[model samples]
Target: MLLVLVVLGLAAAAWARTASRGWGLAALGVVVVLAAIVLTVRPRPATRLPETGELEVGGRRVTGLVLPLRRPSGAQALGVAVLAVLFLGAAVVTFVTQRPAPPDAVFGMVLLAVFGVLFAVAALALWAASGRVPYVGLTPTHLLVFQETAQVEVPWSDLAGVAPVVARTGASPLPDAVGSWVAVRVRTGSPAASGVKLRGPASRVVTQVPGPTGTTTAALIGDVHWAVDPVLAWWTLSYYAEHPAERRELSGPAAVERVTAGDLR
Candidate 1:
């Protein structure tokens, strides 16, 4: 109601000055509202390593590498919950107090109430998971990914290779806005790779890596995306795969410093 009043006042004030000015104000207002609706959360990393750089999670560990995770924002959910409650209350009040209410008023009220309940549930869940955001670690022996409740540790010996893949997400209207992924290519017919799919939840894309002319038989298992920087994740993983001697540093602060600096050694 307050936002509506503010916009209405701005439009009215602008119109008194000039019709063109009023229309421009209304257009700007529409664009602001649309941008807010389009973006789900602030574009930031979902996880961050502390200054010390050495940390342990999920009884597993990793060094240097960082995989992407879906950034979660509880504030966004809570804001929606508050609005849902307000709008729902207004709808109920209007339906009950209005004389000669429309025939569909009750049905509309019911639908709105159901939506309100969903918003409330989302708000509660987000708040509950506030401080426990999952993190990924780099270790010499394995590629460790920690989730909210469980973790996945893929031994370096069991993996064939890792590469950075940029797939056409079509997630945005902008042409250049592509999504990044770290594809852990599993060795074909390797018995150890059989359980790779159980590493995490399910991946949205499972296509093979593109080579010179066609795709390879190496399986792309369940992988995460949207890490703070996918290219860095790929570089760290690949570097360690090629240089087995440096794997031990993954559990130390020096590795974190190097990864953060984008240093090539």
Candidate 2:
């Protein structure tokens, strides 16, 4: 994650520098500070097992394990740490060597402020990533997706179809290959048979869901990218699909009741 931020930060700084060197320096400083915060505030791996629990809905049993998510790989962490040290050293050097000049001092301060903001943002991201699965989960009742601040819940009964999805990182404007993702179609119960779409990056296993009739008809879908384990997500979804009775559909006031009940558990 830090690596991604660093790359992006540098790219943005490069762009900013093309227009204004001072702004570019400020941006670089901001990126450096953000990287530092990320390195310091990341979540450690799970040291103890999560609370093994289950929720029953519609007569199906949904088991859950709250695992602690790590911030970044060890190698990635080390790389960021090293880069941070180097950047800090450079900043210090620039400050000391150029302190006599007013313009240089102002530039240094700008860089300092920029780095401060960047690190602050990185720290926030680390905190968010550590607390919970930002926007993904499998439950007996429904598939929950979090996009930014909005949350969407799709009940098993509403799931009309599922398809594979894949996303890759590259310079190509078009996706070169289909990897893993699930494109779920929900039934809106309208005359037009219209539905909503929810997609995630996951493995091919998502293509198969145990339904009343049998496993679902799997389709090879393209153009989806995921940040989490698609195979695990598939496992969770499959569990719910096989035990449809365990799921429930709640809205408005009912939704509040369901949450309250779950919290008491």
Candidate 3:
């Protein structure tokens, strides 16, 4: 997560540099600060091998890394904390400076309450993010993608295919902020009769792979959407789907690089 943020910060700085001198310098400062803090306590990657070893599923040992929705970064927590403090300070000031029975006192009180609530919510979010957040697990027989409040799991048998998804605006030539992502196509229910019809947000699904029975359901995997190395993630999912027997090779970094180049182009 820290790595991802650092990259994003650098990218932002690069863009800002082209716009103006002061904005670029300020952006560069932010990038440097984030990079310095990240070097000391860098968050782990979203994808990782299970800590408790291989999982048992349907009498078979499933081996593979679990790619969670995303990892939290210290910089985000710090930013949240600062905002919470500012909100709380503003609320206190509003309450303390209010005149009793004044025409705008009621409005001031309400504003103070709102700030207090915002402060509390931000603090709680910081706490949750600081702790261990739930994550998606990727196994030999299954792929779990965690959302805000839910998780979807697709068994290897049901997983039809995986591919890269490039985001695009409707009839717009502008590039999206998030360059690319990976989506996992899963087969749901029995085969459809006549022509296959899979329904969902068509815009989100970049491309479709023929399901096990020609008809299939497709949904985006939010977990790998913001991965540090989306290309590697796509390669991993595609590799496992194509070669399920090569589960052991999914553990090492060198092995992963051998399959899907060491860096993003």
Candidate 4:
């Protein structure tokens, strides 16, 4: 399909150059229609993944898993890299070649200075994200969210229930910030239960649905839309949450097999 589109685009250009502009415009229109149809008709690509047969990520191995993880799609990283390169490149090019009126020169210099800092910050953030790994744990006794510093966790006994939250919840403006996120609804009224946690840094993209407005609480896991198969992860989490007996296999290879075999459905 891509090849066909490329050929059509080339043909349109050639026709415009060698023949008539009207014919080229018509050909280009046909190519556009075909491209739209192809894009719409095809299934969306799933996120790319590293091999999880061993449940290893970033050279770190896991003893168990509720569900295996997926390598985040590099599209976001690539995009950031591209933007950084373009901004930095533009600044250099402007410095070397662009000559403006006297007053505008200072304005241009400031813009160029800002561009350098932006590129540096973007590259640093990208590097940090690429090397990070997030792991969630549900032991026989507790539900743990592994973090780099001093923190607390919810006990399994404290869990009222777990459900997959796929949509933008409530009137919170936070969800509109990122593309896709999985808000895992972890319901509990215990005091140990942590409150709202947003998708600010490398932590779980979470939003707290405290008991004040409602009888239950929630923890939203965002940014995984680019990480894992959101639907599959949703189902698998729900399956383990709802089926207590099934969780016995969660700490072993059988859990991996269950997830792989579509047993969650």
Candidate 5:
């Protein structure tokens, strides 16, 4: 996907050098293509268990799903599709209604330059969309997230607590077009340290964590929030926490000898 965008962006740049105005359309096309790519890339399924032979967390099972947060709903996708069709129709009508003479060399060059700029902008938009959160994982001990800049792993043990932070839909500076997200507050070890905030549909899982040591409790926010069943996640964790016998930790040579002799228990 990234490769295709790069190729399109390069092509747009070349076209912009000759006809600047064409850049706009090329750029728009790039953004649309990139968005489509992100929406189409399927997320991997959640890990159900640790790799074989590895020591499992004592009395703690880890499990959860990581899904794309900004996926467009059926209605939203249809609406956008309709709008695109209408816009395309308008562009076709305009092209058919007016016939202009060929541009002189200088005019053509200027148009090409404009087109290049537009294409560059579109390519950038595509790049930005690519950075959107791809998925999130809730485990017994941590919250794993793939953000545009980096993979964030928030260990439950490190978290002093969790809370719900609200950002209204259409809120300034947020990436999404509609609906705010439940923000998570990670307590800082020091007073000077800053808390991290995870937002958007990606933040849905954070809201499921038991809390009140964290943030303001809005009225039945859970009803409106996008979240997995907290109880289920909690229950799974609790099972691991209680089943210490299932957990294993490796010991020294005696342990290896016992296993080789088929005396491992």
Candidate 6:
């Protein structure tokens, strides 16, 4: 996503070289909006929950909550590839057409160069993250989410609240246009809330720990469709947050089946 924005910025810079300054600025503005979308438009989970099963973690049963696989769609991959090629082609064109750098265009050229490097780095990161199998595990001790940026573990005791959030791209009578999500909040000063100090990229897109939501919670899972059963996702997480003792019951396949079945409704 970051790479996409950078590519657009570079393209805009190239356009600015030959076009009006106003046109260049307009292109940059669009790039900004696209960057915002990358942050706001949470992608739908590509896969359903993990298989209904149990696993032993720290001598206790832990249930694996399936996270959507992070692979890019064919269209997405092809689009990025094409964009990369175009960026390269543009670079060559710029080189071949090189004349004395106009003083006015010097800043633009530097900006383009910087953005090009950033775009490459972001593209590489996205590629590498795609290869890892990301997932979240629910256990009596903690809720573990392994993502591109980080592995987050939130203990049930630290949980503050859980609620459902509905976000929409546009208002319509159609249900498919609405996005359902689960928001979670945790007590301040907890390790999971603040996160352990780590180095490399870990899923830091949303707060792994919760925040204030004025009778609600932090916006978590989102861009969900009706088919994904947001209610079930909300119910399961909320139940665990509110009723820790009964959480162990969900460690069995039968229980998972019942919960999933209910979610379909």
In terms of lDDT, which candidate is stronger, 1 or 3?
1
**Between which residue pairs do clashes occur in model 1?**
62-137, 62-138, 62-139, 63-138, 63-139, 63-250, 68-227
lDDT of 3 by residue, 1-265 (tens): 4543554344343334323354754455465545544543555564543232343344566554654345455556665454344334443444554434364644544553464466457656655765654444466456655544434556767776776655542333554344344555665562212133333333334433333454354445443334435445566567677877665555444434544453322
Put down candidate 2 lDDT per residue, 1-265, tens digits, no spaces. Answer: 5555665465344334333355755666567656655654545343322233343334566653222222334434443444444344444545554536467455654564456456445545444544444334345455544443334455666666554444452335664453555555455452112332323423323433322343332222222223334444444445445556544422223323333344212
Model 3 misses residue 232 by how many Å?
1.3
- For residues 1-265, write the lDDT of model 5, one tens digit per residue: 3544564455444334433356665566556545545543545334332111222233344443332234223333433343243234323433333346234433433443444454445445445654454444444354444444444455554444333334334324546443323333344452212334445544454454424454322111221322333333233333323444422222223323332344423
Candidate ordering by TM-score (highest first): 6, 1, 4, 3, 2, 5
Quick one: best TM-score, which candidate? 6
> Model 2 off-target regions past 4 Å?
1-96, 100-116, 133-140, 146-151, 169-179, 187-229, 235-265
lDDT of 1 by residue, 1-265 (tens): 3544453344333322232344564455454434434443455555443232344534533244444455356665556556355435434554554446555555555555665576568667666655555545566676655554445555667666666665654433465334555565545555444544422212423432342222222333223433445556556667777888887777667676777897745
Residue 238 lDDT in model 3? 70
Q: Estimate each model's TM-score.
A: 0.59, 0.42, 0.53, 0.54, 0.34, 0.60
lDDT (CA) per prediction? 0.51, 0.43, 0.49, 0.47, 0.39, 0.52
Q: Candidate 5: RMSD over Cα atoms?
A: 13.1
RMSD of each: 8.8, 11.4, 10.9, 10.3, 13.1, 8.5
Q: After superposition, which runs of candidate 5 have C-alpha atoms over 4 Å from their true positions?
A: 1-70, 73-79, 99-136, 146-151, 171-181, 187-265
Between prediction 3 and prediction 6, the one with superior lDDT is 6
Q: Kindly indicate the candidate among 1 and 3 with the higher TM-score.
A: 1
Question: Cα lDDT of model 1 overall?
Answer: 0.51
Ranked by lDDT from best down, the candidates are 6, 1, 3, 4, 2, 5
Error of 1 at 108 (Å): 1.4
Candidate 4 has an lDDT of: 0.47
